[model samples]
Target: MAFTPPKETYTGKVYTLEIGVPPDTVRFGGENVLPLHGFEGIVPSRPVIAYEIQDIPPDDWPDTVKKPFKDVSDDPVSWAKFCRDALKARAIALRLIGTHPDRENRSPEDAAKTVRDILSAIDVPLIILGSNHTEKDASVLIAAAEAAKDKNCIIGKAQEANYKTVAAAAMANNHKLIAMSELDINLSKQLNILITQMGFDKERIITDPMCSALGYGIEYTYSVMERIRLAALLQNDATMQQPMLGDIGMYVWKAKETQARPEDVPPWGSLEERGIAWEAVTAIALIIAGAELLVMRHPKAIEAVEKVVDELI
Candidate 1:
């Protein structure tokens, strides 16, 4: 006798979003089942990973995470082009770390110039990020959105404090928005709803439910992302259906496990290997937890996650 395999049927679907223009666009989401649950339902596109670059040199990043791009990190345009040309990055995440009030305090105009330069240097979709300063982001992203106008970029990180301003800028410039919240399903859903309430199209929004490194509240982020995906697939929750973003490198490279020297933490083994594994593990876990888009640093880590995604899908 032959036995039948049990499969879960999903009642809802996630939206597919496209970024960049023809011949260079990338897409994700549009699945009717959970991540890689091919037997359960339809899975349209594989998850995408965007290599992370910065408008200024990543001075605060540990050497292990900084070595790969040491040659091109000095200029945002060179950095972005290297990711696209040499690294063969499908997407590039350009972070305006220099604009932070505590950092270089770069003017909005300077940010805009950087955005334009990067946009011209690469053809892949650009994920424009601010320095995580809410007040500063409100202004910086406006300039960024305008600079990348008609380029089909993703401008983001519209949190609760400044969602209105940021969402309006994204909407006005016709770019996708990233709605971020602390690692809480309820908060993530609320922020998405709020962004939509302000007349931003829900389909154009990406959700960032915050990111934590391995061994550092990562399980909490995992649980929240799982709940969000379940809500989207099982309960048919519209607000939770946006493709999730795992901003991997920032959190992973900063963790002690990734930065500690083998001499200082002898049991941890090679610091370089530990750092890459830490980032790759965190990224893979988030993907399993339902992330459809990932922003990561370190080419080896991104390559490993891409292999995992290939095997899963």
Candidate 2:
């Protein structure tokens, strides 16, 4: 017999989703093999990185990461346009951080208007996110989803505390949903089951099993993602088969390695280069662990990740 390579076969396939209006859309998921294992099965699309922007000025962001958007960060619409026109971002995630009760405490109407403006400005896919205050997100995200109605956006972060409201809004607006759960396989599965139980289609869901920074429990995150993927592909667990979301920039940029100054950490080298590497490493690791979609901040980090994806695919 001719020598043959043994490849693990998978029965389950990730749900394919399209975001943004037609003529300017991106597709993700729909793979039958392990990440980057194209020889074993089909990998229809490479993972996508969506540049992350915020509804208000990102004053909280550290100076290093904040420097790139210094000119446009004051206006969300202008920041989004810069990402689309200059940075060539494939997708844009507009996080309504201003709506947080502690932050600007912007009203739902403010969130809605911001969505409308960003949608009008950018043709790439939009990922609408709330300030992540569970209670506030229930209302804020509802307004944002309705604002982007019929645009095929991904309205997120329906956690255990607020899945019903967010899921209903996404369902009502005819958009995709993101179900987030703490980093546990069982919790992830349970949340997915709960969302689908509320009459939302499971095929339209994306699983965000809460990501972590490179040093802080990233291995735990890695293992959870790996298990989720194995459950989806090997065991054919329908509840765990939705595509994964890394949300890489939020976690990666916060780590000490990314924020520490060269004067403080002489061994780490340049702060800017260190931050970029921090994000790129985390993103690549997640992809290997089965993340099909990512939301990132730094342009340099995004460029590095895209280069790696190009080489792998």
Candidate 3:
């Protein structure tokens, strides 16, 4: 006689992807500790909306974008305060765009002083950015890092070309870092691996999968981020798990979808309203897709995205 045993079946219901970090409580300078990874805990950092300010006047910004900031465009410290006090910004990302040799060619001292001045003015956390010029950033981030010592802020988008010095600064000063790659998983992983090799801890690192605004390869950007998240959870890839960072404002504000004129495209509605919606929609998509921290621009966009986050989490 053949004996029958219990039969087990597998269910197809989707399991949530819990990627990135281990279950150990991670502390940030001893105050707040994040529980788990992957969309964990009140965003722990409330999706920091960093009002973007360049070291010099933003000439390349779209005219419509420039008009809103026209009054505070000249002074960096005043601009920093405006974003924090008036605009109600949670944080600020000061991009030293002027430091690029090809741009105004401002020196490391200039960058350092600006960082010092802004830090003095704003009580909120700051994200000190480089000019996006690889060679210049290597120098600027170090000076800015030294200027911001003990502040415990974030310094970054440290790429493969310049991670050594930047990583050292962040490590020495006890600050967070943004690891950037050119929208490639391998590159992102490689950079993260290299940075940690220099002794920076995992929690101190944030991944910039590199965001693109709507209509301009947003799908590709989103797919890359979503895949990074999936890899972290399913495969338990540590490099992929570090809290994902999105530069929503940088991409969204520059995209045509946010810039379409009412006269040119009647269906898009008011430019300002449409731009804000575009940014919020892009940001919300990222949060749902697993973004922990965001560096955004528009006030309305931040408010809208925060509400959606409140509902989702």
C-alpha RMSD by candidate, in order: 0.9, 1.0, 7.3
Q: Which residue segments of model 3 deviate by more than 4 Å?
A: 1-46
Worst 10 residues of 2 by lDDT: 56-65
Q: State the lDDT of candidate 1 residue by residue for 138-221, as single tens digits.
A: 999999999999888899899999999999999999899999999878989999999998888999999999999899999999
Ranking by lDDT: 2, 1, 3
* Total clashing pairs in model 2: 0
- Candidate 1 residue runs with Cα over 4 Å from true position: none
Each candidate: what lDDT?
Answer: 0.91, 0.92, 0.74
Q: What is the TM-score of each candidate against the true structure?
A: 0.98, 0.98, 0.83
**How many residue pairs clash in each candidate at the backbone level?**
0, 0, 1
Report the C-alpha lDDT of model 3 over 98-178, residue by residue, as the tens digit: 998999999999999999998777676778989888888988999998998877778996998889988998888778888
Which pairs clash inside model 1? none
lDDT (tens digit, per residue) of candidate 2 on 1-313? 8989888889988888888898989999999888888899899998989999998898878777899999999999999999999999889998898999999999999999999998887777999999889999999999999999999999999999999999999999999999999998899999999999999999999999999979988898889999998899899999989999999888887888988899998999999999988898999999999999999999998999999999997
